[model samples]
Target: MWRCPLGLLLLLLLTGHVALGAQKGRGRRELAPGLHLRGIRDAGGRYCQEQDLCCRGRADDCALPYLGTICYCDLFCNRTVSDCCPDFWDFCLGVPPPFPPIQGCMHGGRIYPVLGTYWDNCNRWWQAGNHSAFWGMTLDEGIRYRLGTIRPSSSVMNMHEIYTVLNPGEVLPTAFEASEKWPNLIHEPLDQGNCAGSWAFSTAAVASDRVSIHSLGHMTPILSPQNLLSCNTHHQQGCRGGRLDGAWWFLRRRGVVSDHCYPFSGRERDKAGPAPPCMMHSRATGRGKRQATARCPNGHVNNNNIYQVTPAYRLGSNDTEIMKELMENGPVQALMEVHEDFFLYKGGIYSHTPVNLGRPERYRRHGTHSVKITGWGEETRPDGRKLKYWTAANSWGPAWGERGHFRIVRGVNECDIESFVLGVWGRVGMEDMGHH
Candidate 1:
């Protein structure tokens, strides 16, 4: 038998296995250069580095925030990409990832190889190494697809507009108040000092309230995360950054909020205990502080904001049932959805310094600038002093998480909320909701 060059033979084998795998599925390029070539990805969505030797290129999950690398061209990569990109949802929205019909590597540094890559069944140009742009956008596209596709019911009101137009002396409902029923009580732990997760506090309070309303009757209000974080709402001028207490007031005025439209800043994270008074010169003073939390419930971004709210019992209904349930439980925790592109700021509150969004000069964190209802409020370090704040949680995981799990401010801060809080609004669920 003729002896072939060992290196050459290995390359062919790696290439062959890559091909076989893709063919097995629809078409997935192997993630990278290989040894076994069948390496598995881990919790961080990465495979072991010991298995392959890939050609150098602009890696999606590479340097800095990238943490590690993936062989963009490994077997079945095309298949994986197909399964993820231009998904059913993306197809509906005008913005879909390029796949199958347009196969090819578009590496950051202009390196599109002819031999190492091939566009598979979907007609994509995939290579032996990974093409993160394809992978990353796939998830985003999927989400966008969902947003673009989910047919909105005529009854549902646009949350963004509602948050902006809310006025003081308004009333809505809690599940219990709406149904004119009593609510159950379920106390949870507090997460003291943890910053980024404050949303959880607000969310939990809301959810618990909902469950209580659904389970029992009208209940008392819980603490507010926005108040605790020194970030609350002022007017709908967008990200004016006020105290958390205002969140409840904002919600009372408006039934919901559109977290997708507005962008926020952590410019004053360290200024503790309610953000400075609104910059909206000559603003009218609002009423009592009962505490609160608001929900964005869309997009994959983690951002914080201040808000205001007025106190009132309410019961809410509609697509916002989830938010409504939580809101009725009293002030709860909430979290802006976490995204891969952006990180949450915990080192301080939203004052003095602007939360770093990676780019120094730009100073603006990009992405949907949207929001989500990720996790709930968890109280950590509640031992009176040491670790005496509430923690929040999100679907995004630890890295994007600031504080501990997550956190939100409480009490006085709930007065000037920016977004709308969902719940039974002074017998709202029982109310006509104007039309629906």
Candidate 2:
């Protein structure tokens, strides 16, 4: 004889009704767990149920045909391994379904089933099973690769502190750009290729601009990040990754030649391979100066003159102070957290989206990266909301994001870009101007 547990019997007694099938099927039917009837609605226009649908005496034979599958109304269906019909909660337990309706997400005039994802350029758009829309890298092969910029150690973060005090009643402009203020002086963005050496790229970029602006445009040389990548090897991993403080230290102590001299050699397919041999070398020329020992790597250009910078200084986290430093001086270096979605950045004042908030840990990956903050501005949205942003130059080449530049939300330290800002002075001399 079939026996029902006391607990299940108590549940059956409380329900007061059980609608058993008229005929007992030959064999038990199996259905996928959590299956629900789609396009089927009730009196309340809900998809799960129409009227009372229960079972008689914990019967496993009690089933309803739904969308070519069978769903159970039996009391046993509500066990730890539940395989109850979607309407079981409403008709049997007087409660709503525990999960949302199984529905496809509508996007771009097409319906995507739960968890469907597709990539458009660098951006990945996904629709979760709950019908929620999100934009980020999916759990695909691309997520395996990490971005550049290692998080600064405490020793690196504490080096070279320099503060800028705001003058009393000296109001700053609503917008500013180093390129506009110092036309033809600021270096255009350079491509880092597959190298993860943003530390070198950003340092060289800032130093190049500062040197040009400090020298009054008489010597507007594009300083070489490749020079740093190949030669600055003391406790540093070339191309793989390195610290910004160490990069600046190398710039101050060893110095580097122009891009025309060393030239960038990072290949698009060789990110993990060993960096090329340090082609150019230099010797100290006495009294805190040095000169290149070898010819330019490009061979056509002979200008192998070494450029240097003063000790890089850390700026306060204040946005106004950062703006003042950028306006009064040149482009400043800043470290930012590059979330997976950042790779998809096309335009507009970028703020890290919360679309990936409830995702798995693997899908929420990020890495540290450095950029040059050129200027800032504010924009009023069509809905009257004000958005402030900092214009920055990325080393990913001109093909990406506003022609090698991007504007991210400022003031609130979006992605921690304002946290570890830095500035430096070009160690320029009369001899540097004579070369021009």
lDDT (CA) per prediction:
0.27, 0.69
Report per-prediction Cα RMSD to one decimal.
20.1, 14.2
Candidate 2: misplaced stretches above 4 Å?
Answer: 1-146, 269-273
**Model 1: number of backbone collisions:** 166
Q: Tens digit of lDDT per residue, candidate 1, span 276-371?
A: 332211122234222114333224633222222335332222223333343334333222222222231222111111222222222222222112
Q: Please, what's the RMSD in Å of model 1?
A: 20.1
lDDT of 2 by residue, 173-271 (tens): 999999899999998999886677888899999999999999999889899989998999987887777888889999999889999888898655344
Per-model TM values vs. the true structure: 0.25, 0.68
Candidate with maximal lDDT? 2
State residue 294's C-alpha deviation in candidate 1, in Å. Answer: 32
